[model samples]
Target: MMTFKFARPLAWLLLAFIIFVTVSPIGERPNTVTMVDVDRAVAYLLLGFAFALAYPKQWKMVAMLLIVGAFAIEYLQYFSPTRHPRLHDAGIKAMGAALGLLAGWVINRWRETKAPNGLPFAER
Candidate 1:
């Protein structure tokens, strides 16, 4: 018999949200409740968290993917009429990703210590 894995749905949703926000016009975004740098970091932080949790064993690959993705998205923004690519934004994203990865590591450790379980989420 074969089983299916339906874990990490939140991660999938996070990826979709990231793509949408990245490509959308800057003017269309909601009024900022925080600084731009902080917003960018928070966005990428969640992205990194989702990815790290989804692929716990492949953190290095996740880091590379996140870095490449940050660059790719910024590059795409260069061509958008209302958006500009900035290295500082990318740096913020990298920092956020690092923090998120660290958080994910901590969560994984806690889960392991408490449950000694193979998977973080139960199979559905």
Candidate 2:
């Protein structure tokens, strides 16, 4: 059975992280590598992984949340005078979420396979 005792707190933390990323302006003038877009994407990916790990049985819901959240954030950027929403950014976010989901599934499968008498892992 999945544990809920710690999931609530973790969820809140993840939500905070998402909000921070969504609200904060990234990539300064000229869009130099120092701005670190890759790092930001990885951060979002980790956030997705956290959600997936906390709710493995609800993978569809997790995926939906990630996708919707990414879209919402990008939409919100449209309102910011300092930032403009870009389809490319949304695409990158989606890619990150997908990778995170894949990582989460791999981890879960590994755990399941390690369990006594559990079914062997099979690529799907």
Candidate 3:
């Protein structure tokens, strides 16, 4: 991730943003043209992608965190007076994360095939 050195930190920032948007007052949420489900899917997709790219060796842990965190974070919405939470939404988010994880894994494998030593400059 030399070309994207900030992936790890950025993943954390995205998680923070997700938490804020999930539990904050409805009025504090930003408006978007896409459907609400689509928004959640995309947000978690990127979150999973970032985490996968950042910790390529920890796919199992990352998968657990992103998938479980989806439901865990959604549960937080139950406590918000202005926000409504649904299992459907959590499922969408989890699926999106799973797709993202799959994509990242594909990319990681491709990179490994192209660079056997895990370095662009290393002799094949």
Candidate 4:
């Protein structure tokens, strides 16, 4: 049974990075990345997955944060001088979040199976 005390901090760091990337000026980004919508989704997917791992006991909060964060970031983009908000991006973000949640669930289940204590048993 391995422990990951670093997961929370790393997840928060990644969340901040995602926020920076989202709000920064378009010209500030590198030219190498293509498929803007897909990229946004993938970034959010990773964010969601990381947060899920970090807060395994608070999945509802994680879900709300991911959803709200995705939409809020896109909404805030309207104020950016070089960026305009798009619902399309939000849509892709939702899809990515869903997939990330599923991945995290699977990872957590595997972790529980491998742990000496096993998964938490519900109280009767």
Which candidate wins on TM-score? 3
**Model 4 lDDT per residue over 23-124, tens place:** 889887555375887787787788778777777777678888788778888787877899888888887887787678668767876777666653452110
In model 3, the clashing pairs are none
Residue 104 of model 4, lDDT score = 79
Which is the better candidate, 2 or 4, if ranked by TM-score?
4
lDDT of 3: 0.85
The global C-alpha lDDT for each of the candidates, from Candidate 1 onward, is 0.72, 0.68, 0.85, 0.75
What are the RMSD figures for all models against the true structure? 4.3, 5.0, 3.2, 3.0
- How far residue 55's Cα lies from its native spot in candidate 2, in Å, is 0.3
For each candidate, what TM-score against the reference?
0.80, 0.73, 0.89, 0.85
What is the per-residue lDDT of model 1 for residues 98-120, given as tens digits with 9 covering 90 to 100? 78877876775565556545544
Q: Identify the superior model by TM-score, candidate 1 or candidate 3.
A: 3
- Model 1 TM: 0.80
- The list of candidate 2 runs beyond 4 A from truth reads 3-8, 25-35, 117-124
Per-residue error (Å), model 3, residue 90 = 0.3
Q: Which regions of candidate 3 are displaced past 4 Å?
A: 1-3, 116-124
Q: After superposition, which runs of candidate 4 have C-alpha atoms over 4 Å from their true positions?
A: 1-3, 118-124
Instruction: Output the worst ten-in-a-row residue range by lDDT, candidate 3.
Output: 115-124
Q: Answer with 2 or 4, whichever has the higher lDDT.
A: 4
Residue by residue across 7-104, what tens digits does model 2's lDDT show?
Answer: 54775596676665565665532333554567557756876777777776777888888878887877887666677778777777777877887787
lDDT of 4: 0.75
Provide the lowest-lDDT 10-residue window in model 2: 27-36
